[model samples]
Target: MTSVLPRTKVSDVLFSCCQLLDISVKWTIQYDSPPKYPHYDPGTSRQLLCDQCPPGSYVKQHCTATSPTQCAPCPDQYYAEEWNSNDECQYCSAVCKELQYVKQECTSTQNRVCECVEGRYLELEFCLKHTECPPGFGVAQPGTPESDAVCKKCPEGFFSNETSSKAACLKHTNCSALGFKIALKGNAVRDNVCQENTDTTPQKCGIDVTLCEEALFRFAVPTQLTPNWLNILADSLPGTKVSTENIERIKQRHSSQEQTFQLLKLWKQQNKEQDMVKKIIQDIDLCENSVLKHIGHPNLTFEHLNTLMASLPGKKVGKEDIERTMKLCQPTEQVLKLLNLWRIKNGDQDTIKGLMYGLKHLKTYHFPKRTIQSLKKVIKFLHRFTMYRLYQKLFLEMIGNQVKSVKVRCV
Candidate 1:
């Protein structure tokens, strides 16, 4: 009887049950498919937003639909210091000071730092005073915020009087030039103290008057005295007439002796005697021209003298050299006066000969700066004088030309 049910009825019944199960699952529990489009927002306009702001900058405003993040620079004397989302810059920790200048200027990333200027120094918390270079010392290096004033001892023959930075040690005074003697010799710290001469009479004559008189007198007389006449003049007579005759004869003999002496002097001068050489030299001028001739560069300038001096053992000469040269040249009337005096005092014949030889050579001699300056002044004066003469000549020539032109036109 179980097997007897119709085949059609069994198949239909199985199919209808399966369809009902599928419908129930679909209605009770749903399954979703993939989305149709990507997700987006109106504020960002599909663009990616930025991260936090970096240091030295601040966020001014948030992003909108059409714009990215907006930022602002930190103000002066303020800083952001780090990457921050802050709306405003932070104030600087270090304040500006009236006594100091800016060591490091303020920036968005760095703070301000201050320090002292020149002529000032820094104390513990602030800038204090500056130290000065004292007397007898000079400034080696200027003061700064990091270092105190540097000073050095004065050099030899130099001195400084007061505290200073700009001044150097000055050369000591030359007492000999002003007719004064050095009371105390100069040192590094002190100047040469001087004292005046109390005596009024001239210590020495500018020229040897005896040499000049002898040279002149020798040329004036003419005759020689006989030996017999000299004997008669030496002996005394007994009678008045004989005494008178003897007196007359002695006078005549003396006159003849004077004449002979004068003739002998002339002959010695002609022969160029050693004793008369100084007098002969005196007759010559010893100015710049003669000096140049002696140095063997009569056409050259003062520069030649400098070149010659440099050839000596010591290149640069001192004040003593200048003084010596001045003594030799200043007494225009007496050419060998200084040389003769020097020979008498030192009696160094070899040295005198060497000096004379050097003077005759073509060489330059170094002089003191003061002496050089004086020479430059003289040169300048000469230049001005030459220019004046040239101008006068040119003006006269122009006048002559004009006169000639006018005369020709009239003719």
Candidate 2:
């Protein structure tokens, strides 16, 4: 450039040379010879300017004309650890578990390696589904990495029912307090345990029931058996010398019960919510059990059921309990006779109403297909004592009067 007014001294020139980066102490201006400036050959030396790294990465080296980006990418197993500039790559952090991960920042290259979790093989880079056993069974011997244990049957009393992803099987249903009799020792069902004891109580296997003995149906009348057994001597209610109106009342009661059952069945099919369905079921249960108790001719007598129903607490005597007890009565052959007797003796409204209510309890006993014929006989015999008269008379009361005033059957 230019010289200052007092021409620089050696010390001043030395200081000035320090300001010019290219100027070195070795360069000098001559006093006698003509002044010349030191210069580098154009082909031999070159100047360089550096561009900073784009966002997200730091530079490792300053770029020179000789190199393109000036800064190369950080080494694997390391990353640019700082802003602005970086001379060396930093090693990856030690957060990874054994066999679990690689340097997301490779120890030597750009990114880290990922590994599988411990004790598990890597599939799709993750722990996938687990092997499981079939239902009502469990893995036997042991489970393994290469091989799963074979399925096995559960023992009586205790059962390992389900095979799950877990190392062990799940426990299943037990029989404690069930009062069940083990039949063939219930086995496991699909992943579920079959209850050990299934029977609530033992029932006689089977019995052949022919028509009542001729003596019993014919001459076994009074002077032969006790008061309760009197009806056992006959099959038809009409022949039993019972009241006609009372007999008819029972038929009407049965019809009403059937109607209610059909309504409840429709309600069930509609698929109401759980709590509602449960309430409906309870009602249906009462009606069903009641019919069985009233109609069943257990030992040709319902004395047991009557006694049971009577003994039940007044508050606890839901219709269900009453009906179930009635089922113990055994047969309609006997029920029809009692019904006939009541109708003949008590033609009064209350008595007729009671018989009608009781008739609702008549449910056919479940027996062989042949028993259906016998049931038909009982039904037909009872049918002859039509309740239309009683129904007409009573029709004024419930059909004829208020519904609530209807007399309770057993009462």
Best by TM-score: 1
Q: Residue 73 in candidate 1 has what lDDT?
A: 62
- Candidate 2 per-residue lDDT, tens place, 1-411, comes to 996656458666555334322211122231222122222334447544444432124444455445533334443345543333444556666554444655253433333555544334445545433346565556664543323345565544334444554333334322232222323444454222122231331112211111111101111122222333212211122112322332232333333332222222222333334454454345434433443444454553244434322332222233443354345323443333333323333332222234334334433322233423444543343333342233223223322222223332311
lDDT value, residue 351 of candidate 1:
22
Give the deviation of candidate 1 from the true structure as CA RMSD: 36.8
lDDT of 1 by residue, 242-321 (tens): 22332332343334534333223223333333443343334322233333223222232334343433322312443354
Each candidate structure's count of clashing pairs:
8, 44
TM-score to true structure, per model: 0.28, 0.24
- TM value for model 2: 0.24
lDDT of 1: 0.44
What lDDT does each candidate get? 0.44, 0.35
Q: What's the CA RMSD for each of the models? A: 36.8, 26.8
Q: Which stretches of candidate 2 lie over 4 Å from their true place?
A: 1-59, 62-120, 123-167, 177-285, 291-411
- Whole-model alpha-carbon lDDT for candidate 2: 0.35
